[model samples]
Target: MKKLLKRIKALIRKIFQQFSSTLEPSPPPSYHSPETWIPPIPPVPSFAPQWENGLVLVCSQCTVEQFAGSSHRINRSITATEELQNWLKSRLKFDGLWGKYRVISTSCLGICPQSRVVVVLRNHLVGQQCLLVDPQSDREILYSYIKQMNQ
Candidate 1:
């Protein structure tokens, strides 16, 4: 039993020595000094297509709960934005009007309503108008407002 314990202790020491011998030494602190490093050049930024009239930024993070009878479901913000985009495309298709407007699904605009997504409209005339849009009810009103601004 004593001889077995002695062998185990010797094996552990040999394993530790092998592990230590396999490790490479860390570099000296002076090797990573700031004066020896060169700064990397940053790339120029590219922008989206320039719109003539305006653009709409819809919040993709907004989630709204809808209840029907006994069951309820959450409405995704993306579908609402897509619906708004389609509506805009259909209504504003007159003599380059559609080309001037853009609908973009963006991150949260920070005005997250409990039952609606935040829609920000920007044009040369109005500058900017932030509104909470209910997809089912506010489509017509929103279209009219955007039309008024473009004209």
Candidate 2:
């Protein structure tokens, strides 16, 4: 009886060893770093922007609360910003100020108005001016201001 129990225990131990070895996880794969990781030059050209003096940055992340009867809950800033950009582009080309200024839609510029979009005008002569503009009613005013600043 003792020899039989010992043989059974040894058989169970052998089976457990085989099962555990099959279930054991494999070793992790090795990694090698590339030798030519850094490039010799920048990927793109480094030419300066065509804008001569004025740079207008319009915030594209702002939002205004909608009126009580509107279906949408809020108004997005990009719609207003793009509208203003198109308006300015057409007018600037007509006035021959297209090369003198550039309008870019940018992320939040740190000055966040609850009901308006923030616009930053960087000019060589007048310096920097930050304006809170309502796109629906302030496009002409903003354009006039930009013209004033460039002058």
Candidate 3:
């Protein structure tokens, strides 16, 4: 039993040594070559809403700054903009109203007090109107509003 255990330990050590010796150090990643460093694909351009089209949701004064005990406290600062963009994309897709309107994600709409975000609907009839939306507001409300404006 002792011999067998010794042999197994010896074999394991040999195997590890062989593996370590044979392993070639990986070269540092090169960023100079475009082929080697693939840039992420840009987001698809949002469909322009037909005349009197879609709503634009903006996140104004979005930063690491947070109000105490507010819902925005846990929100990630960097992706706030991306989150708004993606939200518009998903809302448009889920509502089955993708091509019918435009959903824009614009920077700082100048309404800083309204939590972390502000939504605006721009169409021929409504011109430009600001919407005060709760973080939990149903996206369908915006869609329904747009539909009504179209009629």
Candidate 4:
């Protein structure tokens, strides 16, 4: 009984030592200068339109994941499609034309492939319109389309 008790105690100690080693906290790094620290800017809230005229570009979910890629590759959790939508919204907001146009992120619009991001520009006056775009599309083309839609 004495030998058995000794063995059990030794086993328990060994197990605790292994567990404690894993729980050990990492050492703190050497102190760095305050200059080395840079505060991150907080995200701006979504812009709310005052009037609503020009057109709304709906970015579908199908394109969201493909454009965003893995979290490691993309800095913002926002996908490529979302980035485009936000850019449009910001442009309208900064220009104080929030009443003139709006860009919205929408769910899967049934269109997949064609490279991740799909945009549908709808103008009340001109009627509904759709444009399928991929990540590889030229920026100029997108701008031109927007310009034409506004006209």
lDDT tens digits, residues 1-151, model 1? Answer: 9999999999999999999988956544665666565555799998766576898777766642222221656444446666776777777775457767887778877776766768889887779999888876888888877777777
- Could you give candidate 2's per-residue lDDT for residues 52-76 as a string of tens digits? 6798888876642223235856554
Q: Where is model 4 more than 4 Å wrong at Cα?
A: 1-52, 65-76, 135-137
Q: How do all models score by TM-score?
A: 0.56, 0.58, 0.47, 0.51
Ranking by lDDT: 2, 1, 4, 3
**Candidates in order: C-alpha RMSD to true structure:** 6.6, 9.8, 12.4, 15.9
Better of 3 and 4 by TM-score: 4
Over 1-151, each residue of candidate 3 has an lDDT whose tens digit, in order, gives 9999999999999999999988966554675564476556889878644634645655644432234347645635545545555666677678676666676666666666444456777766668778755444545575566566555
Give every collision pair in model 2.
none
Query: In order, what lDDT does every prediction score?
Result: 0.73, 0.78, 0.61, 0.66
Model 1 regions lying over 4 Å from their true place: 1-50, 64-78, 94-96
* Candidate 3 backbone collisions, by pair: 49-101, 49-102
TM-score: model 2 vs. ground truth: 0.58
Better of 2 and 3 by lDDT: 2
Return the clash pairs for model 1, or none: none
Q: Which residue segments of model 2 deviate by more than 4 Å?
A: 1-49, 64-78
lDDT winner between 1 and 2, please give it. 2
Worst 10 residues of 1 by lDDT: 63-72
